[model samples]
Target: MELVFCLLFGGPSMVGALLELSKNSKDHVATSTAFTFFRLLEPHVYFLYSQYRFDKGDIGRLFIAGLGSSMLLGIIVGSLADKQV
Candidate 1:
């Protein structure tokens, strides 16, 4: 199904994107730029996903749900990274 495909494909690319955004030293050229671009453009991706029957409320709600989950995980990972570093 398309939802499975979306999850399988979008999940890793999204994680890789966030990892790249969080790491990388060349702030002016790569990480910051990619992060900004992704931040600016991500709404469009969610907008497309909102057209699906599975989506409730709207794109903003869907994105916020994802953002909430990501932040929870990010906090745990960030804490672990701090201990490691």
Candidate 2:
């Protein structure tokens, strides 16, 4: 089950990393792979942490909180990128 979850999330990430690797810059491979792994780890880490910290009855609150945080993060990142340009 975990293997399938990993493969599903990782397959595209690995493919993108390999594509960058072929471009012959070791730095791109290292960075992209690290980013991919961290991104994939995020939701699992959140889920586990929620399970440890919150009651099952709090699912609705957790869902709302997750959505709000994610949306705020996206907005902040977008603004930063826009500023960077």
Candidate 3:
């Protein structure tokens, strides 16, 4: 179900956004910044998720922790970006 939804909706939207970003003046900077940020964070996120003991019946707590962490990261990054701009 998730894969199907992503294929039908998220896939196209992401493709469209990428295409639009590519044509923009700051495409290189925007793409490189995004790629760099994801590259830096992806490993840490994967490590954290892999280390989490889902079988211990803490799946809900893990999910909430992940969600909160992501939200906090977004807020911090957004504020930093705003300050830089």
Best by lDDT: 1
**Backbone collision tally, model 3:** 0
Residue-level lDDT tens digits of model 1 in 1-85: 9999989999999998998889756664655777888888876686667667546566667778899999999999999999999
RMSD of 3: 8.5
The TM-score of predicted model 2 comes to 0.34
**Which regions of candidate 2 are displaced past 4 Å?**
1-57
Model 1 off-target regions past 4 Å?
1-36, 54-58
What is every candidate's alpha-carbon RMSD to the true fold?
16.5, 10.1, 8.5
- The per-residue C-alpha lDDT of model 1 at residue 9 equals 97
For model 3, the superposed segments whose C-alpha errors exceed 4 Å read 1-53
Could you give candidate 2's per-residue lDDT for residues 1-85 as a string of tens digits? 9999889989989998897767855444355777889889867866886878866557557778889999999999999999999
Error of 1 at 21 (Å): 28
How well does each candidate superpose onto the true structure, as a TM-score?
0.43, 0.34, 0.34
Local distance difference test scores for all models: 0.81, 0.80, 0.78
